[model samples]
Target chain A: MSGRSHAASRLVVAAPYLWLLLFFLAPFAIVLRMALSDADTALPPYAPHFEGFATLREFLGKLDLENFRLLADDALYWDSYLQSLRLAGLTTLIALAIGYPLAYAMAAAPRHWRPVLLVLVVLPFWTSFLIRVYAWIGILRPDGLLDIVLGGLGLTDEPLRLLNTEAAVLIGMVYSYLPFMVLPLYAMLEKLDRSLLEAAADLGATPVTAFLTVTLPLSLPGILAGAALVFIPSVGEFVIPDLLGGPDTVMIGKVLWNEFFSNRDWPLASAVAIVLLVVLVLPLALLQRARQGREAQP
Target chain B: MRKASPGSLRRAFQPWNDPAAKPLIEFRHVTKRFGGVTAVAEVSLSLYPREFFALLGPSGCGKTTLMRMLAGFETPDAGQILLGGTDITEMPPHLRPVNMMFQSYALFPHLSVADNIAYGLKRERLPRAEIAQRVAEMLALVKLDGLGKRRPDQLSGGQRQRVALARALAKRPKLLLLDEPMAALDRKLREATQFELMDLQSELGTTFMVVTHDQDEAMTMADRMAVMDHGRLVQIGPPDVIYEAPVNAYVASFVGDINVLEGHVVAVEGDLVRVETGITGMVELDEEAPALAIGASVLVGLRPEKLDLSHDEPPQPFNKVAGEIWDIGYLGDVTMVQVMVGGEGGWLVKVALTNRRRRAARPFAWEDKVWLSWDVEAGLVLKP
Candidate 1:
């Protein structure tokens, strides 16, 4: 009976590892191999395609760092990378500014109303993401719904030239990623022991001071989790930028899309993807290590 | 019950008896209601300076609510609360000169023990040097000197309780309130901590009000305790007075185990009253009998320790009942023998006998015929 239970536990532990190997690691290996090869004008686009063990050594020898070197040589790639990082960072900050109070209010609401509020937070997920992005266009374009509302309210004299701009792209990204930010924060704030706040007040702290010293410091884990969830995906976002940004908004996601689809430079696009993953994964790993170090203290 | 020595400091301290003495804290007819349910109802109480007071009650008995109102967590719906003779009913908690040790001990998980103690000092914007000195002093006071660097989660249950006490007392507030302070500690640790808390309160000279549901905790630590029931103060006195002279059956049963005999007053002889009971025949009580008229229903409360049991009849003929032993519970300190008095299927009266001798042959067993007797002064006449 013990042996059977041991086998069952092993299978439970292996499930996620097997999933990562089949889906994440396998695709990442393909992308890395393509990133090292040269772009060609032949079928499958990249040169030195694998033909099993017979030509494995020759294929390995043919791979080089030419695509990575090209990425360094071009100023457009550098600008796009910086722009994507900047946009993703700003999006994360704005989401936190908007999400924290929203989550705090939801957590502080009546207990019976909490489930309904949580449902409303994820209500947008019921609609297709592409359709939601499209809906933003109708609201943001010149003389669109937003313009009409402002005009009717006499807030703006002319039609707002908002569509196909960085602002529009930010609006789309923030709108799409808000639920990811709010959910974690709400979960953390709701689980906070209210007695701690009372203890703070009993120890001579005003309500605002208690919030700054106790509530803000305690909810940091939730903020970090939410920032990571929003920032990582926003960095590699393609749909929002393609639909809402103008030519000046040269994010890395759009640059990679152009290389893979329009320019047909799959090797360069693969390099771009790898660099983005490294930039994101490095900071996340460092954060996880710092958290672990803190938890290890006596 | 343990009595204080004749010439000891505790024996001389009785400010509540002095009518001219000023109280450190006062709750004047305070009432608090949560929705449709009243949590505290017109409850008035006072604690003198340097007094160790306790609010003892069962769950939902408004003891906690009364404490919360004093701490400014819950505002009273009516009436006023005065601290140091000044009204502070509308004051917020931070502005009040009061502190509380939470039932959960609610220590800041992210902060170290030293930091937690220094939190209130920092709020006062004291100098860095003074804050450090006071934090060290508080750590030493709680005997957690070497554990200042550890987080609250790293400490044991008893250690965590000390940290909470230190943090609450670090501010040196005019009043310190502790809510269910020892509810989380194990039995042995709780007993030790109770004495430690009493000593700390006396040494600090700070008025401490503790809210607890455990009668033993209140009796052991409190100089004066108020028993609460259903949002009202039922009775308030010293532990011995509350135990020996409970005003009603509820206060009697709540404080300790008691055998209540339903009876009616048959005769009144000044301070003495003779009552007839169906369970144990006629019983006599030496108490104030002016309010208890003849034929009025009353309850006779007798503590188990007050009654003596013997295989043969004792010299006293009054207040005696014959019965067979129904059950014997041999606790380490005392042997509780339940006797069926009068006849079969009659009232079961408990008689507690202290075990003075070590492992001697059992003198009493189940199904043994015994006579239980007590003096007239031992029974308390209580309102039914």
Candidate 2:
């Protein structure tokens, strides 16, 4: 009976991991395979052919150079990449500026009020994310709520243009990604050695000065984690830009999406996919490494 | 704050108070409460220039809260905290001239030992040369001159404590507060550091307020100590005074091992108050305290080493009690023998005997009938 139970326990422990391997790990391999393989038409041609590799090589050789040139020559591709970088940078900065204060306020709030503050910060997450973005459409449209309120106040003669701008896209990104920045930063700041701040204060730093020297530096790991979290996805995001940004706001995700669906150029899409991967992989890897470095500290 | 202790004297001299060598810090009836529970209640104390004081207590006894209030991390719900006679109850911790060495020795991990010590000086916006020179002096004072390059994680527990000390002292605050400075170190290390701390205090001559639950740590370092229990100050005096003459049962029990015999005052002799105990026989204590009427119940606290244990009853003009040896603890320097003298609450009659190689000298062991006695001058008379 005990032996049977032991085997059952082993199976129970192994089940979740097995499920993850089957669902998550297998899908990534499929994506890699899909990235490599050529498309003949309606569906992937499933005959055994090293044609995928041949196509991949040829694709890598001249056409790949053209993709590179596409990024370099026409300012659009390069411009989109630059805009993505710019948007991501702006979003990260804005998120950090807003989230740090909110996280700090949450962490330092009275014990009873803390959870409610946290919930309010995270309430956006519970709401339909898509609905929130759609709500922004209602607010950011020229005759939208924002412009209507401003016009009512007689701040401007015409309804102010808000939607389909870089600022609008950044606002949307920051709103969508706030909790990601806050939760980690809050967790870190909450567990901060208040004594370090006291020690700083005792040592002769004013409150704000102490925060800069002690509290801020100590929570850097959490800030980095939040920044990476917001940065990684924002650079690759298509939905926010497509919804909020106008013609000039073409991002890498949109280009890849256009190649795949609109132009039906799977090879070109794959090539663009490869370029996006190249651009993102190094930083993401470095971020993961940095996180691991913090943990590795004894 | 007319009714002030040594700590209150230091409080009056705090930088924000008098701005000169006026007492440093003064606690004027400062009380703190956590909802329904009061942590520090209507307590007033002071600290003076270069005085080393201690707030000694058991766990959850409001000492830490008092220290926090002084540091400006905690606010008093009633009354005000005066820094050098100036009201600073509302001042934030960073704005206070006081610095604290935290119990955990909270050192910054990312910065090197040098930078950690230099942090406060840097915050003051001192010139680079002055900061460097001060940091070097601090590193040497803590005896970690070459270790400036190492981060806190690289140093041992003692080294980390020294770094924390150096850092707290670097800002040249009028007061330095240490919360269990040696608590993290092992027993041997803690003892060594205690003396080093005394030396450091003497060398620097800065007023220090240390909070510790360890009685020995408090006694060894503090010039004057205020013992607390259940959010109240039980006694405030020099180490010898508090130990030898604790005001009540709690202070005596908290400070050292005491055999408290419950009794009632039966008679009064010249400089001696006689008490008849339920456990021990008639005992005599000093008549220094407020006079107690006959038949009034009291407790006589006797230190373990003060009592003499013998196989044959000793002939002396002192109190004597008879009991059976319950247990024998063989500590190398002093062997602790527990004698049961009782009815309801078993009396822990402790007697420390010198461990001699001579067989004849080893008098009593487990289960042997023994007589425990002490001089009239030994035990203290306190009310429970």
Candidate 3:
């Protein structure tokens, strides 16, 4: 407000600035150094290979029209990328349809009941990640609970093939990422002005129309955030596919995995990781910055 | 259930003398109760076409409840509500031929001013052209022309209030209800907007039912007012009638500034009932109330301006009291003089002394022995 107060606030901010430099900026610098250095057989924080940039260019160059040249055709990279995008997009959409109503119920329940709802949503998160995938595996297998139940009901004559399918992967993806989608959506929807709904009804919108025109539009931010949360995680998801997916249903995460662990091409895997990082993390970073922009508003 | 009262039907047959006499909306013996608590009890009142009516009461007195019921936001637990001689109590709020400007002015922050006003018209299924024209006209009426693209949050408080008013009026419903319309504004803005509301109501010729806790707001805005206490309607009349002729001590105390002196009834003779008090002489009721025998406790209320203060004792036969000036308060427009009558609690007496006539030395200083005096018509006796 005044010149002296401004100076005093600057002096106060200087302390946090020093802390951030020591804790956050230093760690980021370390990551930058590692990302730039070439991989070595020795310990990490390896020698500063100045040619790492040239190496990156060469590695990227090998991705063009030659030995691993199936990437140039429509069948290889496009098919995998398209398949990944479709799965991610559909998974996120399905998650929303299921998650929104669940989130709404969680938010609208009495304040005392919220913690119980939160715990129920988070119970899936508590189990070991691989065990959860294995649980889905147990259900989706041909002679497992799902086929057994269906066979008992006489819906299918025998144990219908259920495992290693796209549907199984989709089901697992939706189930696993649902809580991430719900939390932020619940946070946004819960804080919504109840008056707006009443106002809409008073202005002659039916309950259904009011939800579509008012409730849906105001919850856009939450929807977008949840979609990103589900999409980003699902794009790189390897566990669900590796466990329950069929032979033909390949995704980019499997590709990255095969290159790194199975094929033992660390440089190629790192390149794939970098590509996914650019595609997904860049937007996430921008969205986070936008959120900070809103927080900065007076 | 659809039967109109005998008196109401009889009055409905008479040729209306005033331009504002046609009944637009009527609450017929309506009572709303939430669980064990009655929010409004047997409230039968009518809002004539183009009349600015006010429901004034303290907090939790159900003035807002009555307004909400009229808007069809709250349903009466008993009795019927009528609009244009049609029983519309069962109608939903959206279907009713009325709109309400909420106390918070509930303007949609997401929508532009024009869109907010256009909402009801669009709901009514009017063509896009007609909706646009009406929105433009309504915006202009509220003096917010050429500002259609701006959202509600971008507007100032007064501007938002005007936008809300415009949005409510855009529907051109048979009646418009305002809930504490000026409560959100600053003092100066509130006073200014009160006149604007009055002028707008007159111009539009639409019946307005305003609910407020502030007495002065009701008095300044409404042609007629109903004073309520604890969900019970105390008195309903023109502003002046309700102010000058309150039915009880509560109404008298609540409607305006007054000094209510308690006394015992000495006699009753037709129109007048005389009561003797400790401070003043025999005091008379405003008009004839239900008769009570001798020695019934009563209160006589007097306005501050009516009570004349002097250093010398006035030779008044009745309604006279001796008081010492305990405190003097200087306001630019008027001064409040606190007088200690006997040994007990001192009474506040507002005196309208001219600034031009007062000398350098104050005429009435604290601790001065003075005599307070008034005529017979200066005060009323509250019985209830």
Model 2 CA lDDT for position B354:
77
Worst 10-residue stretch by lDDT in candidate 1 chain A? A245-254
Candidate 3 CAPRI classification by DockQ: acceptable
After superposition, candidate 2 runs with Cα above 4 Å error: A1-71, A126-128, A148-157, A285-298, B1-25, B78-92, B316-318, B342-346, B356-361
Model 3, DockQ value?
0.41
Against the reference, the lDDT scores of all candidates come to 0.93, 0.82, 0.80
Each prediction's DockQ? 0.88, 0.50, 0.41
Candidate 3 C-alpha lDDT tens digits along B254-286: 988888887888988886678898666677654
Poorest stretch of ten by lDDT in candidate 1 chain B:
B1-10
TM-score of each: 0.98, 0.84, 0.86
- In order of TM-score, best first, we have 1, 3, 2
Interface RMSD of each: 0.7, 2.7, 2.9
lDDT: the better of candidates 1 and 2: 1
By lDDT, rank the candidates, best first.
1, 2, 3
Q: Name the regions of candidate 3 deviating beyond 4 angstroms.
A: A1-75, A110-115, A147-157, A281-298, B1-22, B279-281, B284-286, B344-361
lDDT of 3 by residue, A1-298 (tens): 9999999999898989999999977965554444444444544323334356758656544332221332335365557667888999999999999999999998889999999998999898778988988899888888999988888898988876778889999999998999889988998889888767766667787778778877887788899888998999899899988898999889889987886677654544555555566678787889889978965543
